[model samples]
Target: MPADLIFHHYANSPFSEKIRLIFGYKQLAWKSVIVPNILPKPDVLALTGGYRKTPVLQIGADVYCDTALICDVLEHLRPEPTLYPPHLKGVCRIFAQWADNTLFWAAMGYNFQPKGAAQVFAHAPPDAAKLFAEDRKSMMAQLVRLRPGDATSAYRSYLRRIANMVDEHDYLFGAQPCVADFAACHSIWFTQTQVPVMADILNATPSVGEWLQRMMSLGHGTMAQFDSAGAIAAAKAAEPQPPGANYLVDSAFQDDHGIPLGARVAVGGESFGPEPTEGTLIAATRTHYTLLREDDRTGAVHVHFPRLGYTLRKVEAG
Candidate 1:
């Protein structure tokens, strides 16, 4: 059976945008489950067992967290129109990593300034902004964040660096749009599309603006909405395919926490919105890990965790 895809995400999420674009790029049918932008996502938490980031990919009993892993899963599902070209594979990986880590944070910091924040909360209640601010503050561990001034300065520098890349070719790395280009462009898209009041920063780089149009033209493909309950039902109704017989190079299991297989454990990012989920570590491949966790609201589910920026510790000895 062609794997059923459940994208657990919200519309305004930039990382979610990246996956949406990929879905369109591959012309794959996906079920959209609009997760809350903030916390207390009971449905999602139940499925994840703790890792609560946006844009998780669910296929039957397998759940894939992190856009990077989702990208790979999508690639494996549909190889044509490859995101990572054979010749540019190394550069593509490097660029995608940089885009996800650096460009994404910088653009978000710039986009969430006082004006942008006010615009975002314009339709919201008085306490809405306060609650959001408090929630984000708690996530940051009460660290004083970069002021609007610092954010603008940093964002402008990052934009200029991207423009330098475009000065050579239409795309960041080369002629074709690689993983890096799409990953980097989504954050900028969020700035320009979601928070246009502060989008003048893009005017400094005409090339990037042109590139943004190209990326947007790719357009999000055939997306049909489905509720959380429906998604869980779909998952429970299906079974995940075993990862095909492919041997991983230098594949050796690292037993760090003495958490044996089938032990109840949760894996997720360390800091900033640390929502961990409980699951069983059934498969730990070189590229990814699989968690078998069931959600009462949704039924038995399989959640996938990327081995990067995630911690795997036992869920007590119970």
Candidate 2:
């Protein structure tokens, strides 16, 4: 039997919601391991080395970081209800990428305006907002955010564009909810779910609001609660799947980077999340980079990352 899909994410994470909605769309069974929204994510680091993104997907000993790769993995596992439709695969992925980054940041910029931020943390401890701000400040590797005014304008314009797309159909792409729908929805979902005070901005696009309801009706699929200790145990009990056809791009080494296989390297986000995962570079496929990570708790593990929006570097021995 194939290993279970063990997902590590928090309830309030916007990216995690994107993956969760994908699970609902695919109706796939998965195990949920909620990680800390802030820091001290020792369990997460054990699985990802240093990739500190929320919503890490683990299957047996293989740890997949980034929701982009997670979406591809899920689509590979469940191909019937596809995220990448054959007729519009490239366009779907491109739009999804834009939604994940540009739209998400814009939504956050507007969502965190004073009143909205206050409303979001109204129920949490007083330090919650300050700690969160500090944590995110550290995680952000570069200053790519827009000013509040620019963010509002961009978010409004993007909402109208989405409204135009959904005006004709139930989803962003077509009759079905493709990746673009989930990608676009999560940003707006954050605004609606986390900061309703700022969500008034969404009132202008009633079509988008209607589309969100249709998307939410799908619901997250069957999930069993799995704790961090249990996840660590699962990792320790399994062996990393050997490199095979599924791990290869064209069944050969695609050496765009001068560094070859077997060298120690670090793979990390190019524009964000400065933390890098250091390990023996096992595979550098056109689409991803795989590293063999040895943990005392998890033993030999394969950590995979997408090539886009990330960088690969040689890790020098000290």
Query: Which candidate comes out best when scored by TM-score?
Result: 2
**Clash pairs (backbone) in predicted model 2:** none
TM-score per model over all chains: 0.90, 0.97
lDDT of 2 by residue, 183-244 (tens): 99999999998888788999999999999999999899989999999999998999887666
Error of 2 at 236 (Å): 0.4
In every candidate, how many clashes are there?
7, 0
* lDDT scores of the candidates, listed in order: 0.76, 0.89
- lDDT accuracy of residue 314 in candidate 2: 93
TM-score of 1: 0.90
Candidate 1: Cα lDDT at 273: 52
Off by over 4 Å in 2: 245-251
For model 1, residues 1-318, the per-residue Cα lDDT tens digits are 256677899888899999888887778888888988777877777667776778788776667788888888788778877899999998898889888876777787889888988887788778888887766776667334566677678789988998999889888878877788888988899889888898899998998899888788777767888888877777677665454421112234556667677777777665555566677776665566667766666566667666766677777765
Error of 1 at 214 (Å): 0.5
**Residue 33 deviation, candidate 2, in Å?**
0.7
